[model samples]
Target: MLFDKKGLDNQTLLNLYSNMLKPRLIEEKMLILLRQGKVSKWFSGIGQEAISVGVTMALKNDEYILPMHRNLGVFTTRDIPLNRLFGQWQGKASGFTKGRDRSFHFGTQDYHIVGMISHLGPQLGVADGIALANILNNKNEVTAVFTGEGGTSEGDFHEALNVASVWQLPVIFCIENNGYGLSTPTSEQYHCKDLADRGKGYGMEAFVLDGNDIIEVYTKVKKLAESIRKRPRPILIEFKTFRMRGHEEASGTKYVPEKLMAEWELKDPLISFKNYLLKEKVLTPEKDQALTIKIKEEIDVALEQANAEQPIIPDRSVELSDVYKTFEYQHIESNSKAEEIRFIDAISQGLKQSMQQHKNLVIMGQDIAEYGGVFKITEGFVKEFGKERVRNTPICESAIVEAAMGLSIAGIKSVVEMQFADFVSSGFNPIVNYLAKSHYRWNQNADVVVRMPCGGGVAAGPFHSQTNEAWFTKTPGLKVVYPAFPYDAKGLLATAINDPNPVLYFEHKALYRSIRQEVPIDYFTIPFGKASLIKEGKDVTIITYGSGVHWALETLANNEDIKADLIDLRTLQPLDTESIYNSVKKTGRAIIVQEDSLFGGIASDISALIMEDCFEFLDAPVKRVASMETPIPFINQLEQQYLAKGRFEEELKNLIAY
Candidate 1:
């Protein structure tokens, strides 16, 4: 053999060859299924089998793996049962995602593998979170993550590498340089001679591997994996290979050059390994034929079983059941002697209490360490809980969120603070795609809370001030909580921390210091989907939340004769529709006030809700008073005019008169 195999026995080498052959044969059958119109799509990693098998051979069962769509051999090598795998591909109930997804979009915790989403590069950062969790748990288990050469161009690639290096995390980033990304060649994707060369810039050890040689790939990755567990530093391996097939069955190989395709076909990893095994006399021709027959029979049975199994019947109840953990109302007792505190202090106390209550809770954000935060919401937290728990990440929003998803998957509750709510646009993909859809798609619990300090009126222009809760409210799997008063902010944040799904907690920046109220000293949680009736009246109902609640209250105080009922919607998603309908039914008129822009905002939806549910009871058209559709201005006068507050009195009067 060209590569060292001093410790590997003959049986081990035979098993490695078997593992490499399995995925190649399985995917080949899958391609046939695709052609036969039984399967939707097929993405084959035919030539890259050696790297996937070799890497899997080095991995311990307890170690974590975040695999890309192309690494089927990794699953085979890890002893993932063929029946269940085929079940996943066929969208059966026995599949990992229970027909929610197909083709590598699912994973099971039992296997310690995270099945990747369609979007690439984000999983690499998530792997670092797994590594970080392992370190915290003192398991010293290495996490191996895969991506393509094309994925290196993604910003998440660099962010993941930087965090892994800075924290000395035990993660192996394997890049399969398969020569093409869908149709775009590597030449167009990058100028770097080797993708591993980029890893050096991140202050990590990197090396190249001949991806077709199973012996070399296994030996090198095994050594690297062992060293990583001991020292806990990131390592990058660039596996040079070729894509024997097109990106997927739908994409023909027309774009691939005939010469290049022929050359790679000649160097097919399976064929090369078969020749090596024959040359080494590991098996006679008759025995090889017997092994091949056995594998073919196994594949035939798996295929037959998968075809016979009933597909998961699509049900709306399954889709809605896992969005949030259903819990009976606990009815937390109120503290009559509670101390008065500002909104920011209430938030800090909530975080402190949550961290104290749950040892697994981790808080992360920029400038949240010794600097507390830009808003000081996390001030003195590092000192109280230690830096490991209260981490200050780099200015990478996507990685911050992606890491939270990883940590959550690793059985840790993560609370991420977005320095400015407007900055959430940068990390919107993970929040909307991964965290928000995890439970609904695969029943994966993403216990993450993203603290967004939102809204305007402090003269902070567009970039720093934004009410982005509306954007997330439209998403299905996420819970949106926007608190107006200190009592709700503290209680709802605690609830968000305890919830098993992703919650976007929007704290109004304008109310951080403006409002002060007595909050329960003990750790308490407010029930989700419940609105608070701040003031009771019979004439008109003002439905508002966050800073808009304060504005509505002020407007009502000035116009006491209006006899308005002010309802603060503490949670945007899982909105208290019953409370809204009840209030509007009594008052016969309703006004929805919001700090978000008027166009397609939450206020518009609430207004529509009232019109639909309470139309018969209403005396006038459902009114929506929100900020102008235009961006907030830099000038103080124009900024005030741009806000919902500027039109509050006028809109309130119009609604009352109507």
Candidate 2:
């Protein structure tokens, strides 16, 4: 009977059967609803129920599991209320994501389940972070992350596996080889015979199992999870399964062979397990019928309740409320004890102070452990805080950033350093989609500060120097901070670290050593959404941030008659519009200077804002002085010509003359 449920007790066997049965029944009901046009979409895990059920039942409740779109059995097996599950599917306000996201895309911390994004690969790195948190906390918990065979081809898959292996993190990489990624066959995806073979390259123990066999899946996962808890290392298990249904309700399975579908239908996990249970006398006909009726009634009630609850209405306040967790504005009194330091050293001091304050703070990047990073900003951090907090990650920006998301999920604050701001393009998906959207989607606070060494003037070429702050500033739920001087750098960094939302802290590489000031040695935070009035005058208002502040200062210093009120916008997202409006109104003209290209830069947005709100007060047209629309040149002369430095003085004179 089911290959001898030898060590399993009668109750445990019955529980497994019920768990598997419930999802199967639920999927059937969902498919009916989809056809009836009640639900928007459905991703059916019909033939592959055993893997989700077995693996979930095997793990402890406290242990985290990052489930993909099709793992409906995971929610059901965890005994998450059917009402909430149905509500989520129905897109009701009662759902976990409050109708912000649909399907299994929402995660509930109460269930210790981190939900999957549409991009499946990032969650693997997120699971690594969760496992790393467990390790740091000395908890015996092992995290289990699931993905399809199609997802194995992703770079995130390789990066996550290697990182988990190197750290020996307790993670179960459950790969469901479902024979197809969307409509593409497995043959076209990868040439490897089995996905598990790829795990061997990462030096991880690999196993292949019949995913339809409930008993086998359950027994193996239970043993593996137990072993991982004791040894605390990663193991890859490839479950050979088939998707009996289409990828989603709309995408029909026309690409799959009819013969293969028929074969898998016969080997259905629920049918085989039911027959085995009946044969062992663990589940009689009467008991099975009663259980089916019970689950059906439960679903019926949940669906009704979900329907009765209000659907999401178009309310601006409600829509904007959950985008970011409110961080109380902190007022730090000026300290008497001050030490003169460079911008880089000020940032170092801020990080060290933050590390001492937050025990769970983690810093991760390449060469950050001992090399102190390329800029040496984190130099001696490993020695002071040890390697646990100061982590050196492989060149997997996507994975590390996703890991920071996971670490945030586990109540750990993290700071991810991008070697260069331009390199953020590699890790853009997780940062923009997952980390930035987590709070708005499911009320999850991503306490992460991504330290971006940005801007030009370093002669580091196109790939190294960039002012990409506008990318994040436009995205909802992300806080962007760009400081000018050493004092502002230290203070604003402290604020960013303390912020509950994901903050993109842009550190201009040019200002790192060139700028120096007396910064407070003690911990302090400058409030965000508040612009620092660098220099005040009545002729014109110069709105700028990062290196632009220095450019404006240099231009104003060279020309004493310009008499412009220079506003340093320390934070970009929660932009200090009030200050900009007030200064522009007072000056009757404005000029926005930026190191980035002229088109679609922050200056463009500021110019529009001035026109929209302060149009009547303008004596002349609002001007923008910015670099040329070209890749940052490696040659010093070409770079200088491309920068806004030469144009700022002329633009200021023209605006003042008008």
Candidate 3:
């Protein structure tokens, strides 16, 4: 009777068999639809359904799961409606993402299951973030993230695993070692035999198991899930399985060996489970057949229902609606200001005020707890908010970014601090792909702020000093804020914390201590996409932000004859185009300044916008003043020469003369 069924009850065995059968049948129908040109593409997990179904069934419904594309069985086993599943594939209006995406790239707050994007490794870090949040809230829950053997080779895999291990977060990493990454054999993917060995290196309990054996997978995963809930710890389990089909129907199995295909066919999870059910007398032939017929009828009806609905129209208007989760906040009177404070103190006060105002707000960064960060931005925050809310994280930048995404998914507003802006290169995947695009993809608010200490006036050198805001300014679905004044810094951070989209808040290192101004201690809100007009004149317009704004002011003071209109574009993405256009229209001359490099800079974009919107009002060609296209030199004099002050002053004088 198939080795006594591993002490699983007959009902449990029947449930497992049924769960394995549903996804296999659904994917089979999808393959038929693909051939008929009714569907685009399908990633088939036909043979390896047991692993997804087993692990999913083991966890409690409340525990979060981040499932990859192949884990269709996870959705089916969780009783996700077949109509919605088919609707997504058919690109119907009722689909989870409303036809914005076709594959595993949607999520629902109600379901607590994060749908995945094309990039695989970031989800693991996101799951770790969710688990860490659960721990902070003292919620007894474990998070499970799924990936393939190939994903283990990614840097994020190691980054997430190390953070989870060090923090002892409640997480289970399930690696399905199906022996091929799109056509490359597992032998070529890694030198080691088992992916679980990497888990051991990360200080986690690791194991390898028979993935086709549903009973063992369910029992072991259930035990581990229950244990981790009580005392949080991460574990890794590698399932040794094989994909019976090609990567997809289009990418045929030409690279697969005939002998290997034949071998895996003999161990087909669905057929083996059905045979076991029949041999053990778990169900009669008629009953088993009836169950199959029932599931098939259900799938067929779901397809019909999904097909009956209208296909989602590609509407640009609909795309614009959910770009940012804009909210209305209380506006204080004009004279509601409190006291004068430095830029660094304003940041500390803003964070403290945000945390006090919103209980769901938390701060996470490296050495931010007792050590108070390298710049002491978060100093004394630990004593006030406790260590649970203000957390000290490892040097895993990608994990930090992704975990904040997870926290936002769990209905928490997280503020992530990069010790230096240059280090953002390490976490660029999640920053650009996951955090920036989540809202536009699925109508979900990423609801996170990444605080970057940027600029190179202090000669922090190439590694620590960088002005990378230009990169994010060009990206859609992200709000890039670089505040110049202490008042703007405090007010904008408060607003960014409350924003329902991902905002990259760039705090210039040069202005952190050099600039101090009168700022309100009380919470205040600054509307996004609105630039502040620092000075108004008719001769020329100088548009800049962050540290560049100060340089623009200096140029104005030095050359009063120029009579320039100064505009500080506090938000770059939701750019204050109206202010820029109006100023350029009035002055009939414009100069864009930036701390980033000369070529391909934010000033270039601003210059283009001015040309398009105010061409009739122009007096001369739009000019741009930016740093030279090279890394910031260590010497202060060279760095000054590379900056935009002297060049911007010359441009302004020339514009006035013209």
Candidate 4:
């Protein structure tokens, strides 16, 4: 078949050819380097170059594209410096991630490209978030996200597609059916005849196209992008293609049949496109040879420049620098009159104030818009701040968290609320793998806060009542804020919202209406790593957080002769170890209390810290009071036995008597 070249000019056709050719040539060179032990790995995009080039060239420069590992053409089409890209592959300091990551694992804001994490499907939700931002800003920009057919089976894929369709977001899902996902064939991946057919189930428009035909891909995608921009709705396009090479250089194609490889080889995108250009007299044979030589020379120069750059060295200071954005601790003093408010109301007021202060802030959760959430914390928020800001998301935790991450990438801060703290398990991947590692991986600040209604005392059983603060505190690049009192809850939440990093804000479900304090009406922020001293004494030091703080205060009140200094650790990640040590040293005895199970909770870590640092100053062995290592029971009597409250007072007395 000869080329039509109807809507495209000769120059435009030739430019598309050039874009397709660049990545194919670069990939060949990279494979050579991989075999020669110069490059670590290569995910070849030899036959699928058309999809990358076609999709990238179809979109505008400002429209964001979330691409996979094989989309090298996305970088070249955006005119990303070849030297810096090569530097990235070689793990040099001049790389986009400054040698923190390799290959296409890092995103560059300059190119409007959101890099794919290894878990391919989460980026789909990210695309929805970007499109949502575009809609909120009243812009017609669309977001295009790419994934392989194997990725379509992931939960995130279904969740993102459903959410995008429900919200009427302007997004184009480009699923490259590249025949295989790593070693698994499409036959083993899904039951659908075509990946695009899944779009119909999600209530979106669908298309199937020949990915090997560059002209067909380019023309169709350009038209689809324009249509989506005007209509502002999601569209799914499955590009039926094949990966001519192994998943990577190390994984050979022994699993693929020779006949299948031969069939795909004849339909090679670069070769077929070049033949069409020659047949139409759009490109001469002599000109094609010159263009190939030019691209090879360009790759050689880029390799030379990248080779001259110094590789990253392992320095402690340099390695620890970009884990999280540097935050300054400031204690704001307010002279406003105090009003008594419950813990839940304090958090509500703080969130309301933050929304008023930061216009770009968005809050999303289940039943949050009209129903005002399950707890009534966000009651009347939709009426005040519109549906765009106070969104009610589907019961898809993974998609909403990844969407919040996307919002952060688009310079918008987002707050994600888990209906209960135990439900965080569904959204743990994006929080720990993507959101927590975004800054360290690519200097992308994930300005998002995940609010968790945690803890036990209301007999809500295992699923609803569990103190899971340790889940995020152990994960680096995340801040964990757990407060007990109304004043601290309001102050710490405001600080978490303002921090330019991912934060896990744990609110005790039992303390929502149980605890009240005279809190200032105005907004204020408490320092993250500072501990609050409830009372001072010289006999013993009690360390606690969340619900344990109240138990400690009650014990001190009942036994005035115990003479204890009570310390409340407001934030668990930037734990106020200074205050803890000072209090422990002065009192000469320490007791760490927590509501979580006793085996591997935060109390164990605190007890160890006190043992190591306050060893000489201790007058008695450090004691830890925590719940029994059992699942939270449904019965009130069994639940009370499972909690630390049952034994905390006795434990404190035993420690004092020692």
Task: Looking at model 4, report the run of 10 residues with the lowest lDDT sum.
Answer: 1-10
Per-residue lDDT for 405-426 in model 1, tens only? 9898889999999999999998
- lDDT for 161 in candidate 3 is 95
Compared with the true structure, the alpha-carbon lDDT of candidate 3 equals 0.87
For model 4, the stretches where C-alpha displacement exceeds 4 angstroms are 1-3, 329-331
For model 4, how does the per-residue alpha-carbon lDDT over 1-658 read when each residue is reduced to its tens digit?
3455757999988999999999999988888898799999888888999899999999999999999998999989999989999999999988888887889998999999999999998899999898999988899898999999989999999999999999999999999999998999999999889999999999999999988888888899999899888899999999999999899878989999999999999999888889988988999999999999999999999999999987688888866878998877666766899899999999999999889979999999999898999999999999999999999999999999999998998989999999999999999999999899999999998999999999999989999999988888888899999999999999999899999899999999999999999999998888898899988999999999999999988888888888888999999988999999999999999999999998888888999999999899998999999998898998999998899998999988888889
lDDT tens readout by residue for model 3, 1-658: 1434768888898899899989988988898899999999888898899899999999988888899888998888888899998988877777787787886778766667888878899999999889988987889999999999999889889999998998899999999989899999998899987889998789899989889888888999999999998889999999999988888788999999899899988888888878877777887799888988999999999998999998666778777876666566555433565898899888888888889988888888899999999999999889988988898998989998999998888788899999998888998999889987888777777888999999988977887778999878777778898999888888888888887889999999999999999987677778778999999999988899998889888877877776778999998878999999999999999988888888988888889888887999999999888888899877889888877766877777877777
Instruction: Give Cα distance to truth, residue 616, candidate 3, Å.
Output: 1.0
For model 2, residues 361-431, the per-residue Cα lDDT tens digits are 99999999899999998999998999999999999999999999989999999999999989899999999
Scored by CA lDDT, what does every candidate get?
0.88, 0.92, 0.87, 0.92
Candidate 3 deviant stretches above 4 angstroms: 1-4, 332-337
Least well predicted 10-residue stretch by lDDT in candidate 2: 1-10
- Candidate 2 backbone collisions, by pair: none
Lowest-lDDT window of 10 residues in candidate 1?
Answer: 327-336
Candidate 1: TM-score? 0.98
Residue 94's lDDT within candidate 3 is 75
Against the true structure, candidate 1 has what lDDT?
Answer: 0.88
